[model samples]
Target: MYGQGMDAAPNPWFSWDYVERNWDEVSDRLVIHTTLTLQAVLIALAIAFPLAVLARRIPRLAGPITGVSGVLYTIPSFALFGLLAPFTGIGRTTVLIGLVAYALLVLVRNILVGLQGVDRDVIDAARGVGYSPCECSSPSSLPNALPSIIAGLRIATVSTVALVTVGVVVGYGGLGQLMFRGLQSDYRAQIMTATLLCLALALLLDLVLALAGRWATPWLRGRAS
Candidate 1:
């Protein structure tokens, strides 16, 4: 009877049966995980892009601004989330605050580098042609900077997706919750599934962003050709 009971026990390492049984739940969690990641990245981009532009315009402040964001990035995500719990309570808001902080330094530095990389000759020509400040910066400067900016986005996004798993400590960690539950219950299938899903999500997003970047900068293709 003992031998039969042991044989009847589900395999801990891998279980297509578990996945088949829980597909709906897995899908829902995946959607939540993806949404949270995208929200954090977009918010970081919104904050970082303008800051990078301002830093470019005012070179004197650039060092200090990047320094501050770098410090924020250095603070551990768990510590950041814990600190924010008092002010924001334990939830998506706390996770977002931490994720955005981590993303800023990378995004800001890349954007500034991209903008600064733009040719002086290009700017001069744009100005010579009666381009307004907005046109000169946006139409002339931004397109050239797109590749760098997209690179930053890809890095920020993948990093955010990984960090989102950390949020499970606070009950807002999307797929992280599944991982935590699996760990608590000693369910290997749940842990493995969540981990594989996170990896797949990250890879898929990176590919999509890469393609989008290439599409946005058609000249790069032309230049390569």
Candidate 2:
């Protein structure tokens, strides 16, 4: 469609000229997309961390909490957006709600597993050394759990980045909006640019999180070495 011609058709692939012409608009959308993704991840972490701690504290409740989060994760993005549109009105709020809900399952499960994995003897050792409950949990247990927590964070961050693209229908999608417009106008350059940007953003965020994880858990690196 983009290269249709009476005699000879032009190439329908990506065009650097088109990208140069639309660079400003694309850059703006990229910022918005990155901001929205990060916001969703931070909010989800705030909600999930406390619940994860609760699940660790009360072993019996862990299964039910996980089951609930799993159910939330299974809801289709479009369906969730539709459901929230009436209450929140179609915008960033609706998009964020959907993203945060999806992130909770992964974040909460990983945190709970991390905390639970702490050895009982190590916890006792902390207490036996005159460590207060707070110290025992935070300094001792939390550091040990950092690996799992960071793993969950990495997964949630990448997943949210991808999901943000789905928000294009509700008008909150960053690059997704570009992709949708490109499709309607049969612009291969725009489509290719948006898709590549999305991939790049996801990879960039994942790499940053991986580095942060390594920094947070130096002991793991030491053990590996």
Candidate 3:
């Protein structure tokens, strides 16, 4: 029993020395993930917000547009990487493109939901007051849509984190490098540490985003808080 206990127990987490020794590598990889995710999300929002507005106006467009996004989301990440490798090569751009594409599914859907959730009476009142749709929607409707928009952003952020980790599988640097190397080398401690760090990062990102969204959109405080 004593021998079995010793054999079964394993230390699989990062130590202070491990983190200190690799601080630069870890920080650089985290920066890469942050930059990649931010760029991809911004691109997605740019495309998605317009598409969502269009979808709201011409309801018929929503079906096909969302269907296309759904299809893109279902494509295996590695497969998409392979497909893009020919054109973009195996670098950050290729990973960014894939991440943006994946993010669109969530962003567009959320934008659509947010737009649709705007109170029709409020919209009518705004129009009755001689306000243009764009102007009316910008402030009032935006508040109504704030919660949904925040939710979508949250989901997109999470997906971005996971996808960024997978980016290492395609030769793009991130925390996934630690995970991949640890797995390849049969280093249980490193693998566990990497996984925990990734999980912590995801949680931290979500909290920070939520706080930012709440602070930026006061209307959401009533509902999101």
89-124 in candidate 2: lDDT tens per residue?
A: 988999999999999999999988888888888878
Candidate 1 stretches greater than 4 Å from native: 1-8, 128-134, 139-141
Clashing pairs in 1: none
lDDT score for candidate 3 against the true structure: 0.81
Q: What is the TM-score of each candidate against the true structure?
A: 0.91, 0.92, 0.87
In model 1, the Cα lDDT at residue 116 comes to 87
lDDT string, candidate 1, 1-225, tens digits = 111355566646678888999999888889989998999999999999888888977899899989999999999888899999999999989998899999999999998889888887887888898886556666245588888899999999999999999998788998998899888777889889999999999999999999999999999999999
Residue 110, model 2, lDDT: 92
TM accuracy, model 3 = 0.87
**Relative to the unseen true structure, what is the C-alpha lDDT of residue 73 in candidate 3, on a scale of 0 to 100?**
97
